[model samples]
Target: MKTALLLSGGMDSIALAWWKRPELAFTVDYGQLAATAEISASAAICSALDIPHTVLRFDAKALGSGDMAGTAPDPNAPASDWWPYRNQLLVTLVAMKAVATGVQRLWLGTVASDGIHKDGTPEFFENINRLLSHQEGGIVVEAPAIGLRTADLIRQSDIPRSMLAWAHSCHKADVPCCHCRGCNKHFETLQELDADVATGD
Candidate 1:
């Protein structure tokens, strides 16, 4: 089946890309603070992997809240980086583009830890999958690493450190702030991977 990945240039997504090697990849610039860096990183990896990469641009900053939008977090935000319905919006947008390309499956970068947000849960994927499948395109959305942690996904993907280093996980800027949740996760995942290697895991 033809598959396409929502490549965000974050550790999780990058690892998923390397592991799945989808036929195509889509990077959406929804007016996020790190859109430029994310696009650059994603393009570089896609080039190296010889996967066709398409960038979809849509300005939704007015609809966003939290670190990614450079705005205050929504009152109901579950995390500092929360953007309401972000995953839903992104999945919908990607599916819109992917369906036209005859893509039968759309992959997300969500991992187990992301379940802190409702959208990142398995039920969310199942619900969204049903919603999308009920539509004309019948595209299925899946997150293969949803059951695993970031470090585990990295190990399973067996991505080279050099390639993985190209990921840009800063949620607040093109250059990593190192203080944001995204940056924290990036560093933590790397440390975990290093620890595993050192212990021969």
Candidate 2:
């Protein structure tokens, strides 16, 4: 199947890109605090991989909450970094783009750690895939690393350190703040794999 990956410029997605080497990749700028950094890192990685990269720019700052939006998460919020229906929105957007390009499948980077989120669960993917299968394009959504831990996926992908060095995980900074949950998990994943964490310039 002709496949494309949703590249988020994070460790798991980077590893997925390297392992699958998809025909193309999409990095959406959905107005997150890390959008600039994500686009930069994703572009760099795509260049290195010789994969076509597209940036879908949409200002959804109004929909974002918590650390990712530079606002404290609401105490009543279901998850700290939750944006209401974010994964569903993202998948829908990418699928719209994918259909135009004749992509049969779209890959998400959701790993085992992401299971905590309702939208990241296997059931969610299954339902979403069923929904897409009914659409005109028959675009399938797949999370190949959903069963693997971050470190395990990294080990399995064996992505080059040079390319991985460009992956950005901080939710609050253009460069890694090393304080956010994303950054912390990234560091821990690297340590677990005995890999060097890149110090972005």
Candidate 3:
């Protein structure tokens, strides 16, 4: 079946692209603070991997709250970077394009660490999968690394550092505001990976 990935140009998604080598990749510029860097990274990786890349632009910054939107966190936000229904919106947008492109499967970059958000949970994927499957295209949504952490996914994918270097995980800015949660996670994941290597794990 034809497959496509929601390549967010973050470590998890970039590693996934290397591992799965999906036929196509989609990067959405949904008015996130790091949209430019994310798109650039995604495009670079796609070009290197010879995978077709498509970018979908939808400006929803007004609906967004938190670091990603360069705004205050929502009262109900579970984290500083939380954006309400972001995963749902992204999936809906990607599926709209994927279905038209004859894609049978759509992969998300969600990892175990993302479980802090309800949308990143398995139940969300199940429900969304059901919702999509019930529709005309029957597009399946899957998170291949949902059970793994970022470091583990990177290791399992065996993605070369050269390609992995294209990841951009700054939630606050294209240039990477190191104080943001996203940047912290990116740095932490790299440390974990390095520690594993140093220990011969």
Maximum-lDDT candidate: 1
Error of 2 at 55 (Å): 0.2
Better of 2 and 3 by lDDT: 3
Tens-place lDDT digits, model 2, residues 1-201: 999999999999999999989999999988899999999999998998899999998888888888888887878766677777788988988888889999999999999888887898999999999999788999989999999998888878989777888989998879888888899998887776664444321
- Residue 49 C-alpha lDDT in model 2: 89
Candidate 3, residue 41: CA error in Å?
0.7
- Give candidate 3 misplaced runs (Cα > 4 Å): none
Q: Name the runs in model 1 displaced over 4 angstroms.
A: none
Give every collision pair in model 1.
Answer: none
Model 3 pairs whose backbones collide: none
Name the lDDT value of residue 179 in candidate 2: 84
Which tens-of-lDDT digit does each residue in 1-201 have in candidate 3?
999999999999999999889999999999998999999999999999999999999999999999999999988899998999999999999999999999999999999999999999999999999999899999999999999989989999998888888899999999978889999999998898889889998
Each model's total of backbone clashes: 0, 0, 0
Per-residue alpha-carbon lDDT of candidate 1 for residues 1-201, written as tens digits (9 for 90 to 100): 999999999999999999989999999999999999999999989999999999999999999999999999888899988998999999999999999999999999999999999999999999999999899989999999999999999999999999999999999999999999999999998998889889998
